[model samples]
Structures are given as structure tokens and as C-alpha cells.
Target: KRMLAFVAHKPMKIPGQFRKIFYEDFAVHRDLLDKIFWNLVEDSTVRSLNDQLDQVKAPTLIIWGRHDQLIDVSCVDVLENGIANAESVIFENVGHVPMIENPKATAERHLEFLAKN
Candidate 1:
């Protein structure tokens, strides 16, 4: 619950129905959470992808939450600078889970990016 709250800008504002589903999913995936989190941390610390960013040939759309607590928004600068064909959109007043925090905006941006790319 605390982690969920931290990931969202306003977890309390989430609709009850959606919140219920989210909690249920969290419960089902709880056992894997620590392993997944540690793996990501280890991978990021041990592996450096900065050199290979230019190898990516596909167009990329990077959507991020400006208020993300888990991953700082400053990382967007590195991505934008590294990838030749990369575009980014930052959601204001949103945290880590932009898809759940602002589904409409997230969907709209994804559709737009898909249509263009």
C-alpha cells in the first residue's frame, strides 16, 4: 500500500473500482516484487547502455511522469540525448505510474505516437 501510494501522485484520488483491481494485482504479484526490483537495480548498476543507445534504429517515444519518485525525471535528458530518433512527453502532476494515474492522457499520447511512427 505504501509503495503503491508512492508511485502515484494521488493514490487516494483513484477510483475505488480501479484501486481494488490494482490492490488485487499487487497482492498476486507481491512475491515477485522484491526480486524484480532488485534485479532492475542490479542491472542498472552493473550494465551501462549509454554506448549502445545509438544502435537503436527504431523511432522511440518516451513517456514519463515529471513527479516520478522511483525514477527521477532527469533521466529523460539522457535518453533524449542518446537516441537519434527519440521523442519524450512528460506528464505534469503525475508520478511513476502514468498509465494508471492518467490513463486518458497516456492512451492519447500513445495513439498519437503510434499514428505518427
Candidate 2:
């Protein structure tokens, strides 16, 4: 969880001022905000996911860290097999958000993956 979990843990296209207002002026407290934000996330997830297991129609790639604290590492396997055509790469030294923490390495790894695939 983020020290600032008030905002959903994702990048955005929403206006900066508006994002602040929704997250602060309207949100009375952190606990309430966390509940609301998580609820919204769940609602949005249900809207997108029609089934528990889905099959991809195209090639897919999954990059995961072995020591991810936010989620179980086994989730990568679940994702790999769930897709129609999928493969994965795991970084042993990483925790979470490898792209944010190591852009250069992530980019290099991505370039390598693209070149090979």
C-alpha cells in the first residue's frame, strides 16, 4: 500500500487541480477515502472483467518481480497460463514497481524482449 493510498496507485490523465479536490476537499478522512477508492477500483474491475479466467487472442508478455511485496509472485504463473499466448520475465532483485525504480534496466530488458520476440 502507498503511504499516500488516497490516490489510486496508477498514473493519470485527469487534471491536477481536479484530482486534488476529489482526493482532499471531498474526502473527509484517510480511512474513508481508502474505502471509497478501493470500492471504486473493485467496481471498475468488475465492469471490465466478465469472467474469472480469460484467454488472449494475441501474444502476451508478463514481467514480474520475485519479491513483490504488494502481491504474491505466484500470480505471474496464473497470468501466464490464463492468456492464450503468453510468456514471462522475472527480476529477482526487484520488489515492486521495477519500471519506476529502474527505468534503464527495465527499458533494456524491454528492448531485449522486443528484439527476441
Candidate 3:
């Protein structure tokens, strides 16, 4: 149950039949996950993006999940305040991956951002 909950916003929401397939995919992609960790997580620059946010000149749309446990929602303020032209829209019931938890709304917000920009 704990492992299932780790990948999903609410593990109860996931159909039981799909759970097996999800875990199977994780096993198959374990190597890729390890590579991502070494390439991104272990990289020092990724930890200090705040200092470089000011370098971003393009119009930025910061979409975050208010319930995200992986990355705190408070970081949105850092990006919004640091970036020259930035906007944000947070999803209340969503978790770490907004696109997976609420694809329709996420895609709609993305389209709206593109249209406005």
C-alpha cells in the first residue's frame, strides 16, 4: 500500500487491475530512473535554480499542485517573484504530477498560457 501510494496522488483512486502494470513498468524502467537520478538529482546546479531564475527572460507559466509532496508549493513564490514575466495557477486537489492527476485542466491551462503569451 505504501509503495502504491508513492506513485499516485491517491492510491485508492487507481484501479486495482492497473496497479500491477504500473509496478511492472517501474521495474522495466529502473535503469532509466537511476540514470535520471545521477544526471539530474546528483547535479549541484539543479539544487540552486533560485539564483538563476532571474536569467529567464521569456514569459513563464508556473503550474503547480498545491498538494504536491515531492516539491513544496511555496517554491512557486520563488519562481513567480524571481522571473521577470511569470504567472502561476495551482491545482488544489492535485499532487506532484499535475498532468497525470488532472490532465484536462493541466492541458487547458497550458493552452491558455500559450494563447495569452
Give all candidate RMSDs, comma-separated: 2.1, 7.8, 2.5
Model 3, 1-117: lDDT tens digits are: 675366446645667678778978899999999899788766756577788899999999999988877778999999999999999999988777888878899999999999999
Candidate that would win on TM-score: 1
Ranking by lDDT: 1, 3, 2
By summed lDDT, the worst window of 10 consecutive residues in model 2 runs over 3-12
* Candidate 3: RMSD to truth: 2.5
Q: Which segments of candidate 2 are over 4 A away from where they belong?
A: 1-53
Candidate 2 local lDDT, residue 51: 46
Q: Which ten residues in a row have the lowest lDDT in candidate 1?
A: 10-19
lDDT of 3: 0.84
**Higher-ranked by lDDT: 2 or 3:** 3
Q: Between 1 and 3, whose TM-score is larger?
A: 1
Which candidate leads in lDDT? 1
lDDT of 2 by residue, 39-78 (tens): 9789967775324437466667777766676766798888
TM-score of 2: 0.55
lDDT of candidate 2 at residue 28, scale 0 to 100: 71
